[model samples]
Target: MESAIKWTSNETVLGFGKDAIAFLDTKLFSKKSPCDKKMYEILIIEPFYGGSHKVLIDMLYKALEDEYSDSKICMVTMTAKKWHWRARTSALYLSQVIPKQHAFRVMFSSSVLNLGDLIALRNDLADVKKIVYFHENQLVYPVREKKDRDFQYGYNEIVTSMVADTVVFNSEFNRETFLKSIKAFFKVQPDFRPKGLEGEIRQKTRVLYFPVMYDVGSHSKDYESTLHIVWPHRWEHDKAPEDFMKVLRKLSEAHCDFTVSMVGEQFTDVSKAFKEAETSLFPHIRHWGFLPSRREYLDLLSRAHVAVSTAKHEFFGVAMMEAAFNKCLPLCPKRLVYPEIYPNECLYNDSEDLFTRLAAFSRNVSAIKEVVADVKLDFSKYSAVNLLPHYVSLFK
Candidate 1:
C-alpha cells in the first residue's frame, strides 16, 4: 500500500485508508521500530507483554514506528526468577528490554509494586509521552479483595499508573475495577478531597483493544491432534483450574473420551488448586506442566481441539485469543472480558452453563470441531496495522 504525504501552506497532510491487510505475527513482533530517527520517544510500561498482549503492543509499536519516524518507542518490563511462566514468556515478546537505571529510580522503598515492570518500563520510557498499559491492578485484583500484603503493593500500582501521561486498558471492565479501588482507597483520607482524581484519570483512559494475531489468510487449515485440549495460561490463581477439572470429571463420567495438554508454567509453591485437580486429571492427561518453549507450546495449541478458561479474573483473555487463532474451540466462563472476547458466540451463564455446553460438545463432536474453523476476531481492529497511526498521533 502506497502512503501519501501532501504538503500545504500551513500543514502537511498524511493519507488515511490503505490496503486492507492483516499483518504477519513476525512483522508485528519484530523488535525494531519502522523508523530509525529519535527526536522524541513513546514509552510503554507494563509488567509483561510476551503473551498475547506483547504481540499486540509489538504490532502497535511497529505501526507507530512506521507513521512517526522522528519518535523513538520503548517498552519497559521487569523480570525476576520469582515471576510466573506467563510473565517470563510475555517479556520475550518485547523487541527490546528496559534499561536497569529506570527501575532502580522509580521505587521509593515505600511500597511493593505488584507485577510492575519497573526495569523495563524505566528503560523503554522516554521523557516525551509516558503511557502505562495496565493489564491488572494489584491494588484491586481479586487477591487484593481477600488480603493485604506485608507492604501494600496496591498503593504502588496506584502511584505508578498515576504518573503516566496516558493510561490504556485492554478492556472497560479493567478500567472500572481500578477506578473503584481508587475511589474506595481515597475515602480513608478525610482531609483529602480527591476532587479532580476521577476526571484526571478519565481523560487519560481510553479502551484500546489488545491487538491479536488472527491470520485467517494462511492459517493452518489443517490440524492433526488425536486427543488435544489446550491450557496455555499461567498455572496460578485467577484462572480456576478446579472449574475446568470439574467439567472434565463430568466428561469422564459420561465416557466422553478426550485428552488434555496443560501447557502453562507453574509458579512458586504448587497452587493447591492445581495440586488437587491433578488427581482427577491424571487419567486423561497427555501433556502436563509448563511447556519447554513458546514455539513448542504454540505448536500444541495448533493441534488442540478445544481451549477453555474458568478464570474469575481476566482483563482480556489473551490466551483464549491464541487458542482461537490456532483454531481451538474456546469454552470459557461467560463473564468479564470473556463476553467481549467472543460477543459473536452466545455467552454462557455460569459453570453449569459451561458444563452443559461441553456436554453437548462431547456428544456431538462435529459441533465442537466446527468452532476451530469458524473462529473469528473482527471486532478488535487495533492490530499493528490499524494502531500504528494512533501511536504516531499520540507522539505527534
Candidate 2:
C-alpha cells in the first residue's frame, strides 16, 4: 500500500466535516498474514499526519526505506485535521486498522496517539520496541485560562510516555518543560494524584532536533531598498499573529519602508488579526496566505530580508530555521526554542524591543542585510544529513 493518503482540503469523509475525520479502506492491511512470511522490521504509525508531524514521518520513511531496501517496512497515516479528535480516538481506530498478526521489531509514533491504549487494544504490538516522538507536549501548551485547559490532553502525553520504551523530544527545552510540568499539570485532579511519573518519564527521554532539508534559492535583488519581512507560522492564536500585526502596525505608523509577507498553513480557526491586517496593513502586504508549493515558499523566504516569529508557543521551530537557511535574518523571541536555535543577536526581549529592532532595520536595510550575511547561524546540527543517521539508529 502507498504510504501517503491523498485528500483535498475541502473533502469530507462520512458525515464529518473536511477537518473532522478521515476514512481509509481497511482491506489494505486486513489481508491474511502467514507465519512463514518474513516479519516486518519497522512500523511507522502517525495519527496526526499533518504539518511538522507529517514532515518528520515522510522524512523518516524515505530515509529508512532507502537505507533498508532488503527489509520490509510498514506505514499507516491519517490526514492532519481535527487534531483533538485524532488524539482522543485515533488509537482505537488505528488499532482496528493496523494488522493484528504481523510481527514488527520496532514501532514509531508521535505523542498524538495514545501508544499505551493502542498497545492495550492490540497485543500484537505490545512486544514491539515502541518509540514515541514528542513534537509538542500538552503540559506547556498555552491557554487563555487554566480552566480552559483540558486535563485529558496533558494526561494522555504522560500515559503515552510511560508506555513507550523510548521517548524522543525535538529539543531539550521541550523535554524539560514537559517533565517539569507533569506534577503541576495533574494538580487539577482533586485526589488520587500520580507521583514519580516525571522521574520515570525522564529515564526514557532524549532530545533530537527536527531534521530540516534546505534548498538554497536565488535571492531576489529587486527589493533591496525596502526591507522584506516574512512571518511564516500557522494562522492560530498560539502563534500570536495579533502581536505580530501590532508590531507591523507600529512600523507602518512610523512610515517604515518595508513589505510584509504573511504566509503559513491556514486552518478553519484563523486569528482575527489576519482579517484585520488585510484592511489595516493592506498596502504593505506582499504575499499572503499559505503557499501550496515548497519551491514558491522557499523563493519567498529567499527574497525576504527578515523572518520574524511572534509565536507564544513553539517547541521546535522548523520555519524559522528554514528562513535562516534561506539567508533571511531570523528575529525571534528570547524564550522557548528560539534561544536554543538562534543566536542572541537574533532574539528580542519584548515586543518593544522587537519593534525597535525592526524599525531601525527598516530605516536602513543594509544593516539587517549585513547582519544576516555576517552572522554565522550554523544549521548543520539540524540538517537531515547530520541527523538521519541518528534516526536510523532508533530502528535498530
Tens-place lDDT per residue, model 1, 1-396, is: 011111111212222222112232233332343222232234444343344444544455455555643134444433323433333333333323333223211111111232244434434433434556666655454554443432245555565566656676777887887776677665655675456566677778777666554433223423332445677777766677766788788878877767788877654577777777777778888788886555556667766777878887788776677677666777776677777667546367787787777666655556666655565655346354465556446455
- Cα TM-score per model: 0.69, 0.89
- Which digits, one per residue and each the tens of the lDDT, describe model 2 over residues 1-396? 223332111222232122111221111122233222545667788888777887787667656766774246777788787888889988988877676657688999999998879989998888899999999988888898999998888888999999999999999989999999988888889999989998998998889999876565556644346888999999887889889989999999998888999888975565566788878998999998888666577778888989999988998889999888878889999999888878888999999999999999888887876787777677889987688789989988
Q: Who wins the lDDT comparison? A: 2
In candidate 2, the residue pairs with backbone N, CA or C atoms under 3 Å apart (3 or more residues apart, or in different chains) clash, namely: none
User: 166 in model 1: Cα distance from truth in Å?
Assistant: 1.0
The best candidate in terms of TM-score: 2
Error of 1 at 321 (Å): 1.3
Indicate the residue-level lDDT of 357 in model 1. 74
| Model 1 lDDT, full chain set | 0.55
Instruction: Name the runs in model 2 displaced over 4 angstroms.
Output: 1-39, 221-223, 269-272
